[model samples]
Target: DAGVTQSPTHLIKTRGQQVTLRCSPKSGHDTVSWYQQALGQGPQFIFQYYEEEERQRGNFPDRFSGHQFPNYSSELNVNALLLGDSALYLCASSDLGTGGWAYGYTFGSGTRLTVV
Candidate 1:
């Protein structure tokens, strides 16, 4: 019954560099979603993965990509990062498919990325 966990609670990077963040989904969950939350803004859906395939994605650039493994964990990779990429990267977990409100999406505290 573990909750979602993200690695490197805080991170600092420079412009034009690449960074990868890891996430472990809650137990008994097969779906993982990534979100980017800027200061004082609601989380913006970056992408969602189910069955190891991307089911939906938002209007992010190609630089934002992700992968979901067999164990339902995930990793988000950003290449050629920019200052604008500095934000709270969140990883949420849910059951396969969507239906109930309670089991929809449970978000982690997130990995704070700071690009200078």
Candidate 2:
């Protein structure tokens, strides 16, 4: 089955601009979560979606928002991006009520965003 995928593999943007990243969940999964991982740092969850609704969220500014479609794909949007916003954006997919895969969530490589 196809695993999670994200694009563009990399991004470059200026401060105060807006950016949107996309993600497609693994086959048969119904939940998607967005995370931000700074260089050499662990991922910080931005939000999670299940059944096309925002089921959970993390500690992030309102500038960080996301959406999950009925097809289980998702998009993350950041407004007024700052240099600090530059980070590797990761998209994780899970089975929702099914407790995910045996090894837990399936994560995409990531979208490397560089805000200058």
lDDT by residue (tens digit), candidate 2, 1-116? 88999999999999999999999999988889999999999999899998888888999999998888878899999999999998999999989667754559999989999999
- The 10-residue segment with the lowest total lDDT in model 1: 96-105
Off by over 4 Å in 1: 97-102
Question: What lDDT, from 0 to 1, does candidate 2 have?
Answer: 0.92
lDDT of 1 by residue, 27-77 (tens): 878888999999899999999888888999999999999999999899999
> How far off is residue 11 in model 1, in Å?
0.5
| Predicted structure 1, TM vs. truth | 0.94
Question: Best-fitting candidate, measured by lDDT?
Answer: 2
Per-model TM-score on C-alpha atoms: 0.94, 0.95
